[model samples]
Target: MSCLKLNNLACGYPQHGTKNSELLVVNQLNLTLNDGEIACLLGPSGCGKTTVLRAIAGFHGLNAGEIWLSDHKLADVNSAVPPERRRIGMVFQDYALFPHLSVKDNVTFGLHKLSKSEQNSICHEMLSLVKLEHLGDRFPHELSGGQQQRVALARALAAKPSLLLLDEPFSNLDVDLRRTLALEVRNILKQQNITAIMVTHDQEEAFAFADVIGVMNDGKLHQWDTPYNLYHQPNSRFVASFIGQGVFLSGRINKQHIETELGHVACDVSSSVSENIVSENTETHVDVLVRPDDIIHDQNSTVTGEVCGKIFAGTSTLYTLKLPSGTELLANFPSHLDYSLGQEIPLSANFQHLISYAKETA
Candidate 1:
């Protein structure tokens, strides 16, 4: 059984006084978190990802369905079982560390409920877990962004909580620091074997830190899968465009081969199912997702496109190409192979992995 399960949950505030006045923040949300797995709620701003987290934390009540935490039905409607009673640790975007308190004291604050010896032992273990043992005396303002974030993590872990909730924990850090802290935090959580639910709008962070990523849009989860599967085998067009860098183009399937305007790709969307194209349907309009790496600049290729723009990003160059049919596509080429702007270059779609979306379904 899963450690946490949300069954058809609907959460929102009632606007004004009408039966249909409830603004659905999370609509029939269903999710299951296995023990020791890190799941992420990812989407753009105002997608109700944070609301779902709050609901899970028992800060908000659900209007329909149910929530279970290890076989306990949490259905308190009036007075929430206070944040303290939930045994859930939280890390926010601002770090939320007490400015006046030292890192060690902050970590020990939650441990005060235990015996003196137990508090000391737990504080020591959490500090060690976040690699901030030596800087325990430092105040929040005195530490760097990464160090402060680690201290916040240490404080959360010190409680020995059943579950952890992180709300954009690295949003305030720089890009380089964000990347490093995400990896470090993921390592710490995995080492302790903690089950956590994190909310972030960053695709990179979700891909790096989460074992299962739930992509939310318009207050609903569209897809929940591993990072590799979400990228390579997207279930919907919204998922295909939202999960990775890609430009979707119109295409048609012909005898197990998909023919797009760029090129022909042969990949089975239904690998296990033995369902071919229905009778009298030779071509179906499918939105083909092509990544920047999929389009290759080959001089011997017959297809050519005009380079609309180019950006040198150190390791690779991002090129915006305009095809003859007026379709726009982005291509990533090695930085060593220099190309001029507005130059007509031969490009071909070399992607073996194809993700297709039916027009009606997408």
Candidate 2:
């Protein structure tokens, strides 16, 4: 079942110096989240991802389109249900906890309509759900960043909302903590079967937390897909560049294969080539997306490149190799097989998904 839906959603802000004019941020955006599934709006800062989140949470009104939660029509251009009535929970970037209130008090804040015994019961359950049962009496300041975030999550889930919105819920934490807490929160959401949508500029966080990810740029959603597909089978050039680190290797379509600097590797050239390029034309130029993992350090291979740079990442080393044609490529190899810079190392192309775009003429 569909838990939330955004139909032709358009939102924006007022024009700076013009009357009767608006700046459209999100235009004709459409997405759907199934019951208990988590989604993410991932993009750079000022990409209007947060605006979409605010619109769904009732903080912003739609210029056009409807917001639906299951069978309920929550908002449209003509009218909107208030934020409180939308049964939507929000976990802000700062983990907006009340410093004056204890963990129990904060979790029970929305339970005022229930009896005192009921509020306490729900608070206990929520705290236990977030693994903070022993910190109920502690204030927000008494807890660590991760603990406070967990409390915020507990507070959001305590209301039993139909949908939850998280806006960079782990941004304030350190890199390691951000990843750890993201996974922890994902497990908690899954354990409770809570449907959620999070907005974050960090792709790693999105990959860790969301079942579906929508990559946005310039107020437009470029692609909505799984982390694996977004990385492997990007729908657009922007998605291909934005999702992961890679270098575009100049190649030519050769029947069922793509001829590149590395080597001629057979691929489904017809489907992978850009629409403007005719796959039947063997001379048609194209730029193939080559990720670090696509390049293998094969000592026996005839093709080779000079090691220009290397970053040792404990278990693995990312080597920057410069091909004779001056095309730079990144290759990931085990740290133990370290090679000094300027060494000519044998390399091979391991094309998993041959993604290519038409070459632009200067």
State each model's CA lDDT, in order. 0.83, 0.92
Q: After superposition, how far is residue 43 of candidate 1 from its true place, in Å?
A: 0.7
- TM-score of decoy 2: 0.97
Residues 1-362 of candidate 2 have per-residue lDDT tens digits of: 99999999999899989998899999989998999999999998998999999999999999999999989999999999999999999999998899999999999999999999999999999999889999999999999999999999999999999999999999999999999999999998999899999999999899999999999998888888999999999999899988888999999877777789888878776688864658354478889899999999887888899999999999999999999999999999989988999999999989878889998679
How many backbone clashes can be found in candidate 2? 0
Candidate number with greatest TM-score:
2
Off by over 4 Å in 1: 16-20, 76-81, 267-281, 360-362
TM-score computed on alpha carbons, candidate 1: 0.92
- Per-residue lDDT value at 336 in model 1: 95
Q: Candidate 1 lDDT, tens digit per residue, 142-239?
A: 99988888888888888877889999999999998888889889998999998999999999988889999999998899888999998887777688
The worst-scoring run of ten residues by lDDT in candidate 1 lies at 271-280
Ten residues in sequence with the least summed lDDT for candidate 2: 274-283
